[model samples]
Target: MTVPVVYSACEAYPTVRFVIATQPVASSLFVNPPQNLTVVGVDVKQRYKGTHGIWRLMGDLRREYAIDAFIDLHDVIRTHIMGVYCRMHGIPMSRIDKGRSEKRELTRETGKNLHPLISTRQRYFDAFKRMGFDFGETFTSVYPTGADTTLFADITKPKSGGERWIAIAPFAKHEGKIYPPGLMSLVVDTLSQRAGTRLFLFGGGGYERDILEEWACEHPHNVTSLAGKRYGFAKELALLSHCDVMLSMDSANMHLASLVELPVVSVWGATHPYCGFTGWHQNPANEVQTDLPCRPCSVFGNKPCQRGDYACLRGIDYHAIVQRLDNVINQR
Candidate 1:
């Protein structure tokens, strides 16, 4: 007797492609490959410009790629619009519900009403499930491809004398989530006291990079800035993988470090781990965030602290982080 086989679109359709409509930050987190995924980075400016243009682009994507199924990793207004287009075109669509976990925690923490049950990664996976893919079976690590690896060759250069180094990703896309330069300086200084360890800073060149560079100059022997170093995401990963550990803000670096399997000392400010975006792919060796009542004011951090004081981050003692790093370095 012959056995019957069932095939979903993802399986039946050998040419499975993914259209990732998300911001750069979110796309950096959601975009994965070897499953034949194609990411269409939603240009923030273009999407914000006009509703019709955004819809038109969605239509174009639908017609152009003949996209089998659409996954809105970002379930915001823009993605909603695109999802509608996909549906109108008779294409199945899925969106990850990112708010469920946060909603649960918020109700418990603030004594507020339960919002909803959703999670960022879960919502993303839901899109696949809609097309007959099991979330558990399909779940895979987000990895950099050959192109990505090629991009980071320069920055991932081996250190002289085969010395081990610690990477510091101090700059966050949002200023509110960034630790103050003075506080970071203290952390770097404390870490520098440990011999045989080198410090390399990672970030794009900007005012924050300038500030970090100034701090690095103060401790020239132990610290150096690799912020402006021309490396792509893949190269950054390579450099991150080479590090003994990473000290980073609660930003994309946390996710990236997880992908590289580096031990991360994540410093939190306006954000908290309960948001579910914390170090999903990396080992979080230490999480340094003040237990402030006003912590996690928003799901995504804002420009300034909502309560003016920014106690969530400002209250975090620099000494605590130093002690954690000391323990990590001094461990037998």
Candidate 2:
């Protein structure tokens, strides 16, 4: 999520020469970053304690590049350590305002009136504003050039008279966010029956692979499974970009699809987009969610259902979602 936001800043302000300090995992996420952006991988596992973080940067990049200011957007205890290093080095710095108070109101159990909070992307821009940079542009995802179409093989793009390609990513990190598998099977079955429609199932893990494989075998020619293929991100991202529409849980796929500007029919379970985690430039109108009183019980959908039954998710009508997808597909 934060990846695109930082990319936008670097893209919008090409003259700034933004040096992005992040965990080592980021090295995999932002492959072939733009000219102005330089990602410095910090050993997050080390906790940046003792002689790590700002101290390390101060000794190396600071001496070489003549460093000026610091902006710690994470604002976590770990990043705070970097801020301390900035102060000791006499470099000016600012941290992003996470909009904690607004988020609190959106997620609170009692006396809650739900409304959209400040977007995480906007907050990143606001962080830049504090550093005397005003970025008025919207967020966009960056992908490798000439994204291979061959990896998709028989799953072609939607032609004027050809198949409408659909990617179904029906898993989230937690059970709270996942739509019922039986219900998702119905979505696959209905869509697969349509003339010139190809359904591709996307997910990871052996268990997810088994599930997708079973569905693919059941449907035969129309359904193909992309799970557990280990195609690597560069290939998967290109393949994802080829899709016409992505039916997904409110997980990474929503944001991943947004990068390619592919429209998403995201099913919300325990987490609401109102908490400011919606994908870059994704329309809220396309979102599929019921307005249950206990809609957003957890920010990340990792919490156990306080109601025990998880009415927030089980109560959602899958048929309604299918109808909505029909509408979205026609518009596309």
Per-residue C-alpha lDDT of model 1 across residues 1-332, encoded as one tens digit per residue = 00001112233445655454545644444323335455556665765346787787777776777767766655678778887877787877777666655554653446544332343454545655665665242222334332343445554445656465888888788777888877878888887777777888877887867877887898888787877765556557666666777888888777677665667788888766666666644444588888666666665676467678777777888898877765654552
Clashes of 1: 10
How does each model score on TM-score? 0.78, 0.88
Deviation in Å, model 2, residue 81 alpha carbon: 1.4
lDDT of 2 at 264: 89
The RMSD of every model to the true structure, in order and in angstroms, is 6.4, 2.9
Collision pairs in model 2: none
Clashes of 2: 0
For residues 194-296, write the lDDT of model 2, one tens digit per residue. 8888888889977889999999999897888888886665566677776678999999888778776778889998889988888878888888887878768
Off by over 4 Å in 1: 1-15, 21-32, 41-49, 100-119, 137-153, 160-162, 283-285, 303-307, 326-332
CA lDDT of each prediction against the hidden true structure? 0.64, 0.78
- lDDT, model 1, position 167: 86
Worst 10 residues of 2 by lDDT: 151-160
